[model samples]
Target: MQLSWSQPCSSGMIQLLLVSNLLLWECVVSRPMCLDIGYKKLFLQELFDRATVIAQYTSNLTMQMSEEFDENFAKNLEYKARNSSTCHTASLTTLEINEQIQQTQSDELLKVMISISRVWYHPLEHLVCEVAARKGTCETMLSKIKELEEKNQELLEEMKGILVRVHPGAEENAYPAWMGLAEVRSDNEDTHHFALSNLLHCLRSDTDKIVTYLEVLKCQVIHNNNC
Candidate 1:
């Protein structure tokens, strides 16, 4: 079957295919198609494993970004505090501005971290469990996959905006860079965007293949039943 990104497999179609495959497998012990049952189970298990790995990788990357942001923000704060003039009034004003910057940076990092957990990590982890236990219908699993894909896309857009602001450029830095301190490199931002986009593409491809495979199985079952 041809997989078209333009035309995703509908939830109803997935449910129909899965139900057909299940019903056919139940009576296939004495039939020539018995081996297909084992193959289907193996294929699904493998897909689940791949998804689990991708989810774990994304989660780790997000956590790493969060920690790095926190450390850099702290260092920037210290640098500002130390460099401000010793005059009491000047120091007070500097402190207030530094505090506001810290708060803003903290809020942005927290937003990104929370979005990553809510959109990608939590749902995929739950999906791994469901697939392993064979507890949910294929349609349900596909729906979750679709949701993840959407969330991943949303995250990519958000990261791009953050990268544009934080990336070292000619303009005033959205994230203040400490002169002697190690800066958050532009490469790190690129890596994060590339990783997420790659994962999202892979997931969409895998989901399409699974749906196509199920469609093929359903057809074979119908043909055998007709015979």
Candidate 2:
């Protein structure tokens, strides 16, 4: 006997399929759903609070370091401000993830965040590595940078987990050409000081952007429709 595509399933099969679908949807709607994931609390208050504390601590540390760089390393000398296109800072990392952009679909928002971390992570890594290699670098700042990098990774993973549930379709994101900081020659004292100083400024600016974007994302994620 030939079976047809139109053939109906047994009543038991239908019930099984229906229940499976319901459970799947529940997983999605509940967010961070299931025992496997970090629980999805409405408004993600705990997550936001965690992010806020981290942002404030990192930003303040960055600002302090920037000031320290200016005061100590920047001995009075005629040094031209070196703002190379390749060696620019991370201030604009959040330009794509602002409040205005939050009005877009949450899935898209999550994707944007994931993309930002991918693009922004390495540049910060390169910046920190460069600083760490130099003598007399502040151990505290280095520790903070390491902490910031860890947070970035954690945030990326968290977004990715949500995205899989929300929108499993992730296309390769295009990073801004300037997002990747290029290596520079620091042969001269003036050049080294200027380059290092510029890097600190860039990292500082980037930290501010990260903090701002995190707050926006935290509120957006937690409030959901209210956002």
* Number of the predicted model whose TM-score against the real structure is largest: 2
Query: How high is each candidate's TM-score?
Result: 0.24, 0.59
Q: What is the lDDT of residue 172 in candidate 1?
A: 24
Please list all clashing residue pairs in model 1, or write none if there are none.
none
How well is each residue in 1-227 modelled by candidate 1, as lDDT tens digits? Answer: 78888888989999999999998887775465667766755554443344334444444443443233324332344433333322211111111232343333322432333233333333344433433343223554445544554544544454333334333332221222122111111245433323322333333333333233223322333233132
Q: lDDT, candidate 2, residue 34?
A: 49
Residue pair clashes in candidate 2: 43-222, 90-206
Candidate 2 lDDT over residue span 1-227, tens digit each: 76688998889989999999999998788764444354546335565566567656767876777677666666564432444333333332346435465565565555555665566576567757866776777887677666767766775665566556445676635556443333333566666667666666666665576566666666666665464
Count clashing residue pairs per candidate.
0, 2
In model 1, which runs have C-alpha deviations exceeding 4 angstroms? 1-31, 74-227
